[model samples]
Target: MPLEKIKVIAFDADDTLWVNETFFRKAEEEFCALLEEYLPKEEANKLLFDVEMQNLPLYGYGIKPFTLSLIEAAIKISNGNMTIDLVQRLIEKGKAMLQEPIELIDGIDETLRRLSEKYRLVMATKGDLLDQERKLINSGLENYFHHIEIVSDKTEKQYKKLVKHLDITENEFLMVGNSLKSDILPVLNIGAHAFHIPFHTTWAHEMIDDKIDHPNFRSFAKASELLQIL
Candidate 1:
């Protein structure tokens, strides 16, 4: 498998195109602080992540689900003794996050601008549909993408569907993103090419420990680096 076969290049949203995980991390710190009396910051953070994983099937991903998880975790951490005021604050926190301005990743705009000229670019990511769309519009990179594929989760099956929908074979698709778990591994498993451009922060649920050594997989430190090889 070489670069010449790649016909469609799909990019992950959130941390891949712009800033995302940092807000979640900051909110988590604040969340733990708000619940400091009930649990230490480290323990509270772990509990929150556990609650999120448990709720994923029901709620999917986004600020709304995260907000709900915050409330649920808060109640559980406080033995169901948390006040309504605390819940209100969590609600407000989620609203603030949804309204936060988009910050493009360094070199991402240039990378996208350049790549769009050579390939059929698509934004293939998983998250709450409305929120992801909002970010895409605000990101100002929407025009560069020929198609947008937003799913509840990124998996081998989903990747296969995307390739079919694009009227391309698995070997003709290339996925670029920050998370190895959601963005890199599954795409590669589907016999597609994948490039990992890791962000500084990653959600606990998206973390993985395995070393990747696939022939179709490559890792880079920044978005611009894609130009050198692509």
Candidate 2:
């Protein structure tokens, strides 16, 4: 049976709605290549990613402070050569991240517009509060969503909270995201429906080492095509 009976449709804001992770991955690569002479490729990226992983507890998720982590790694390894030039470059990159608004995935808005008329639309995104809010406010789709939840993590806790607030059952709602670990599994664990759309660029931290081949999880190739499954 298709997920046609779902009354509430919740969407993941990051890669599901638009392009994300790719910019950061490119930044990380460029940043690492700059230091690749001093550090092994694996060692360089691992160090940068480690610094970022630790900063998550303090800064949460966003491109602003993630750029800072890269700067920190560069400075720490610069051997007293950390100049104003490097810092200035990092600052420019961070500003670019902040100013460049949402890049919607193909057919995302059109599909959402169609779905909004039939089902309750909610933004189920997880990231830094201010950054996520800025993206939403600029995306021009803010008016379409009835509610938005930005959290540190996308566990069952957040999903349960949404169900409680909306007065809906787990079975009546559908969770859609690019991340299987954070977005698809937990909701499916609770018996809610899920749609998984793999991203073109995936962050190392957000990746799942294991693959999923399950009955309840529906994987779609394009955003517009999601309407068919629904």
lDDT of each: 0.95, 0.83
Off by over 4 Å in 2: 1-4, 40-42
On TM-score, the leading prediction is: 1
Q: In candidate 2, what are the lDDT values of residues 36-137, reduced to their tens digit?
A: 767876788888889988888897788877888978888766764777887888778877877776888889889999989889999998887888888888
Could you tell me how far off, in angstroms, the CA of residue 88 lies in candidate 1 after the best superposition?
A: 0.7
RMSD each, Å = 0.8, 1.8
Question: TM-score for each prediction?
Answer: 0.98, 0.92
**Number of the top candidate by lDDT?**
1
Determine the C-alpha RMSD for candidate 2 after optimal superposition of all C-alphas.
1.8
The residue-by-residue lDDT of candidate 1 on 72-144, one tens digit each, is 9999999999999999999999999999999999999999999999999999999999999999999999999
